[model samples]
Target: MNEVGVIDWGIVGAGHIAHRFAQGLAHVRDARLARVWSRRTESVAAFVQRHGGEGCGSFDDLLASDIDAVYIATLNDSHAGYARAALAAGKHVLCEKPATLNAGELRAVLETARVSRRLFMEAMKPPFFPLYRTLCEHLRRDPIGPVGLVRAGCSVANVPAEHPSFSLDTGGGALLDIGVYEMFLAVDWLGAPLDVQTFGRIGASGVDTFASVHSRHEAGIAQLFCGLDLDGKGDALLAGPHGYVWIHEKWWNPVRATVSYAGGRVVELNVPFEGGGLNYETAHFCELIRAGELESPIMTHEKSLRMISMLDAARSALGLVFPGE
Candidate 1:
């Protein structure tokens, strides 16, 4: 907390996604950008200039500051290390998705947060979206009549070979990058799976270029597809005996949705939001911090752990392993 009763945030990693998160800070009234750190001084300087924050000489300097929370947006492999350091420094953490490379790493960081008594949450923006909230409410009312299947995909074409997204050492793969969103939707809708099966096309770099996962849950089934080497329709569909709901393209950051019943009636919803859609999560984080909460109700630590565990299983089935793992 700051002098003005707002949460002061220190951002780690000044990448493109980090800049978008800074843009989201503009839409949050209870949070202020306070400090930023990155391995490259030039990137940190640019981020500070564009986002109105002080540039830290190193990540240690940022953690040593009086910031209320640290937002980890670095490469997937470094999430646990930075989050552990921040928690040890008595700062809350909002790390980007795939909180760590595997469930084991996630457990370690979460244990540290428990001991430090600091709030820590994975930065999953969609769960806080108004569109998703409305969808959840409708589902709770049983309008869909027991959802039996969920199909989701997020795929992009032709990522350059040199991109970090294709490096095994960096924890690069379709599963960690975009597949996590699909997994989140599945788990949020159907709970953890009883069984998970996965198949993938591994690249020369040992990272997956394309992947498909199927999970069986008590409620029904979830099928997710993600790829860095192909284009996809980019939508998610939940279906039941009586009706179905369709989240629009880019389902992860959906702006529109439709619900259709067996009786030929359909309802469409358009969700309007501000500033890159990350503002929703930023605002929610501030609310939880102010309320003395350790995790988000919408995206709880348990949910994150389950998601990572599923990912770990999927990786094992697909025979995909990071360099150090």
Candidate 2:
């Protein structure tokens, strides 16, 4: 409850991503870690001890604490529930990607946030980064000279059965976990597609292990693939008549890019930063909350809903049905 000149933040869920967000907070001038809450009391206590913050025993206590915002880093299934509770309690919210299990859930959360007049934003990570902004600018300048096709993919070794990434009931799958990155970029660059065709191979747990999707935009097309059954270096390419931009390891905080064209010409761009790239999203969240804005022009609510709808269609095409849904 101390009056610091920064946005007081309480982090919910003590996971790997939560730690990254905490570390990223050090670089954000307008936000500070005020408290932490987790089902594992001892773990939350340890997090507070190490991070110089307080540990609360329950979500009620954390929400009632002197924090301006609640960062929900819990499992995907828990996002909507926690965010709704936070918004109802008069607090801003920054939730992790796949903010909800489906478009319906996203709609429900947005409706609740709207009714409560509170700010709610998803932590998609890439759109808020500097490199993506720069890339958008170049593309707008016709650097690519009329994009013809976009091919993007993200695939990694399957998670162990014990890992949360393998749980279907918790909304675990390549699409929500990693495919959204490629999908978001495609939509951001080319807008919604006229049609979407998808093919996926589901795991024994009823989650899609691999998905190959084609989005046909009016102007061009986006060919995207994501999987847990294969391991390959991920890249996103925006191709055009004149040149193409290549983003390496595009999903996990891209640091370098290459633009290549005919005549063996290549231009490499380096994205510089002071600390962890996670600062981008956190900083953007602070700005929006400080300005009393509910929606972001860059990462709009409509975009989130549309992306979820695409996933819904893809699931229907692949015959994927979550448990108890």
Candidate 3:
């Protein structure tokens, strides 16, 4: 950060999620994408042209640039490497999703952040959304008692077989690509997983096509699922002794929810988001940068590790292992 309090950002990938980040950055105050790098020069050029950032020829160039933070928006397998490199370069890292392939890899990445004394966070966007925030506050004022059971899942059949999400070499699977989100919700609400029981199918691409996971957490139990070749669907439920909260379809990107009480009263929450929804997390990251914080209170390192550990266990149960893991 300069004297003006502006945070210069470097992006490691120029894919769909990166584009969403660039769009969301416009809404964050005093944060700008100063540099961007990807595997393809043409993709970098196109991204820079639209997002107004300097195109770097290599990942090293992006790291060497005078940027305050690096957003790792690459594929699942490469997230750990980019995060480690950026943090070692003395740059704060906001990695997309699962953070790393497994618990061991995430532990290594977290250690790097500690040694480098830089902020590191996984870009989990749900809890930062307006509706989620509202739900928390509402539950705090009223009483939902202790949330014990969380049920959430998402499945989609629109993705073609050629999509990177089904490629084994890239570490793409419904478990990591889609189930990670559900895992986050489970851990966030129910606590760390105690045991994960999974059943799924492996596709011809050598990745998981679908998975149904039943996890017992410290607080309660959660039932979650994810799929790449199924119909597009989902909703989430948080059940407690008093009542339950129902997050409408596509709960991960939640906008509306219904809170019911045992007293026969219902509360509806609807808080629409702006800037394509990624801005909430990006803005939170910027706030962390300005505060000189090493970790986010909401999306803590422990929560990330717990989420990935569930993914690891689920994958192991289904006999779905990546190439190098």
- Once model 2 is optimally superposed onto the true structure by TM-score, how far is the C-alpha of residue 270 displaced, in angstroms? 0.8
Q: lDDT for each of the candidates?
A: 0.90, 0.83, 0.93
| Worst-scoring 10-residue span by lDDT in model 3 | 1-10
Task: Residues 183-288, candidate 2: write the lDDT tens digits.
Answer: 7777776777678899989888878888999998756899999888899678888888888889877544777778887656887777765557777888888888
Tell me how far the alpha carbon of residue 302 in candidate 2 is from the true structure, in angstroms, after superposition: 1.0
Q: Which parts of model 3 are misplaced by more than 4 Å?
A: none
Error of 2 at 134 (Å): 2.5
Superpose all Cα atoms of candidate 3 onto the true structure and report the RMSD in Å to 1 decimal. Answer: 0.8
What is candidate 3's lDDT per residue for 1-325, written digit by digit as tens? 7647899999999999999999999999899989999999999999999999899999999898899999999998999999999999999999999799899999999999999999999999999999999998999999789999999999999998789998899899999999999999999999989999999999998999999999999999999999998985689999999999999987988899999999999999999999999999989998988898999999999999999899999999999888888
Total colliding residue pairs, candidate 1: 0
> What pairs collide in candidate 1?
none
TM-score versus the correct structure, for each prediction? 0.97, 0.94, 0.99
lDDT order, best first, reads 3, 1, 2
Error of 1 at 70 (Å): 0.5
Best by TM-score: 3
Candidate 1's C-alpha runs over 4 A off are none
Name the TM-score of candidate 3: 0.99
Q: List the residue pairs that clash in candidate 3.
A: none
lDDT of 2: 0.83
Best first by TM-score, ranked: 3, 1, 2
